[model samples]
Target: DAGITQSPRYKITETGRQVTLMCHQTWSHSYMFWYRQDLGHGLRLIYYSAAADITDKGEVPDGYVVSRSKTENFPLTLESATRSQTSVYFCASSPVAGTEAFFGQGTRLTVV
Candidate 1:
């Protein structure tokens, strides 16, 4: 089974537009996370979910929102896309907190 999956591996959007990225995992892991990677900022956690219906903001959660309605699916939405938000997004899942996480290939989003 596929461990993790992210949709639209690459995307290009205009500024001020709304965009949504989809993530899915097959392991039914207890923890799921959203992260954004940039040159200077490296990778920063955006949001995470401990389990279904449980979510929390991460270090860089201001411009993004995430929800986990089911253990296998976690989707992230960018309310108003910005050039600053242009980066690689990754979805990861782990069986326990602080444990090894399995990540998707990553989605590269470009906001013009």
Candidate 2:
């Protein structure tokens, strides 16, 4: 029963408030990513980490922050929540780039 999991499947926060979506994997995958899923944009990469202490910005990095202190955890934080940031966020981990990845159930965040 070891797999990726996200905390707070759903969350509601006010605009300007800061919110963080946590992701953890028991498999110790080397590649972890944070993506936001919206109506028209589909899945947009927000950030990713190749290894512990190594992170990089992705397609949409503005307004978001991510860090990976451990190989098994990747957390994404919205510095200042906004209505435009309201979307379903997904966390995925892969053994390597360009390979199949395992995803968490996702976190639904509503910024109002």
Error of 2 at 60 (Å): 0.5
lDDT tens digits, residue span 1-112, model 1: 6789999899999999999999999998999999999988888999999999999999989989888888999999999999999999999999999898999999999999
Tens digits of per-residue lDDT for model 2, 34-100: 9999988889999999999999999999999988999999999999999999999999999988898
Model 1 bad stretches (over 4 Å)? none
In model 2, the Cα lDDT at residue 53 comes to 98
User: What TM-score fits each model?
Assistant: 0.96, 0.97
For candidate 2, give the lDDT of residue 9: 100
Angstrom error at residue 55, model 1: 0.5
Q: How good is model 2 by TM-score?
A: 0.97
Candidate 1, pairs of clashing residues = none
lDDT of 1: 0.94
The weakest ten consecutive residues by lDDT in model 1 span 61-70
